[model samples]
Target: MPSKKIVKTSNAKKSQKQTKRDLKKRNKKITIKKDNFLKEKFLSSTANLLIKAVSIAANAAIVNREVGKRLNRRGKEALTIVSQLAVDVRNDVKQGVRAAKKIQAKKNGLKNSSKTRVRRLSA
Candidate 1:
């Protein structure tokens, strides 16, 4: 006798649909959280950098060549961080657009592959 595997075939598709729906909803929340995280990260970095610059200025050593070089390096690093953040956000938006288009295509149906013409308005 051969052992048979049990499978819930009908609910399999339904569960997949439910998972996609849940994923869509969860994605929105996750995006907001990501934005918040990036915002907080950038703001904190900017604040700390500002404080460091202010301290350097208060010490009246801003005129020193070494101090100027340090500030320049810090500024360049900050710019690099911000640029990378922008790239990440832009990539996320592009991914979202691609997902939206895929979903739209699925919703439009596979009538092109069907032998029979799909009736419009169910007339």
Candidate 2:
């Protein structure tokens, strides 16, 4: 009687297939986790950017309003100064004209007196 040894090859093949399935499952789970993490990060970052943009815009608007108010006040002050200068110039011109008229009248009186003396001497 000869004793024969039987090798179980099917069991080895089954184990290999099981290991391959497990590896595929682990890789799928890892990819899914990475994708979810990326999505969450992107969404949070975008939300933060939007919030910052809105805040900056609000601050800019407030600054613009303040600057506009200041410019308006300064413009009014400048306009007042210009108007006052114009009035001053008009007053100065009037005074100059009056002085010139007085001087001309004196000159005319002197000429008239001289002419009367000349006529008296000739007569």
Candidate 3:
């Protein structure tokens, strides 16, 4: 009597190929997830800032136009209030830009504090 061993070559090859494909798929999924997460965050933050800016500007304009017309004696006060609101909106826009720049720098593998400080100083 003789003992014989059998090796399943086709099965082994199939498994190897499947593992490689699975690895590639996993890496692709991770990259896509990271990209989508970053995109979503950027859009959400940008949308919030835009909404805030529009709201502030609309409020300031409405108050200046409506309140100024009714309170004839306080035209100067209304103008001053509108001016202040404009400044506030400007500051809000600047803050949004700063935040975006910081995120960009970080993504580029730059030191956030030093890069941000330099950028701000130059501005």
Candidate 4:
């Protein structure tokens, strides 16, 4: 006895072609969805980067302004201290001049009378 061979029919061929068409359509839909998702992700990331850059610039400007204010305050404080020192030195010089004139009058043998003369000269 001989074994009989199985053969593919027209109905099987038609079903295979239908399955291939279905698979192709499903792949196309998945690819389109993936592309849309990637586009959205890229746009969101770019927007975030722009916002961060603006924030950094604003922070830098604030820091620069603060530094300028600090420098100005320090400069004013230094000016005030120097001006006060100058006034103190001027007072000290005036007092020394008065003391030296009094010593000179006493050495000239004019103690009581020198008082009236010194006062007149100072005025």
Q: Give the winner by lDDT.
A: 2
**Local distance difference test, per candidate?**
0.87, 0.95, 0.92, 0.91
Clashing pairs for predicted structure model 2, backbone only: none
In model 2, the runs with Cα more than 4 Å from the true position are 1-16, 120-123
- Stretches off by above 4 angstroms in model 3 are 1-10, 74-123
Tell me the tens digit of each residue's lDDT in model 3 across 43-74.
99999999999999999999998887878757
Clashes of 1: 0
lDDT of model 4, residue 54: 97
Report residue 91 deviation for candidate 4 (angstroms): 4.7
Clashing pairs in 4: none
Ranking by TM-score: 2, 4, 3, 1
Instruction: Arrange candidates by lDDT, descending.
Output: 2, 3, 4, 1
The TM-score of candidate 4 is 0.52
lDDT of 1 by residue, 4-114 (tens): 988767888999999999999999999999999999999999999999999988777645867789889999999999999999999999999999999888766565534
Q: Write the per-residue lDDT of candidate 2 for residues 28-107, one digit (tens) a residue.
A: 99999999999999999999999999999999999999999999999999999999999999999999999899888889
lDDT of 4: 0.91
Give residue 53's lDDT in candidate 3 (0 to 100): 100
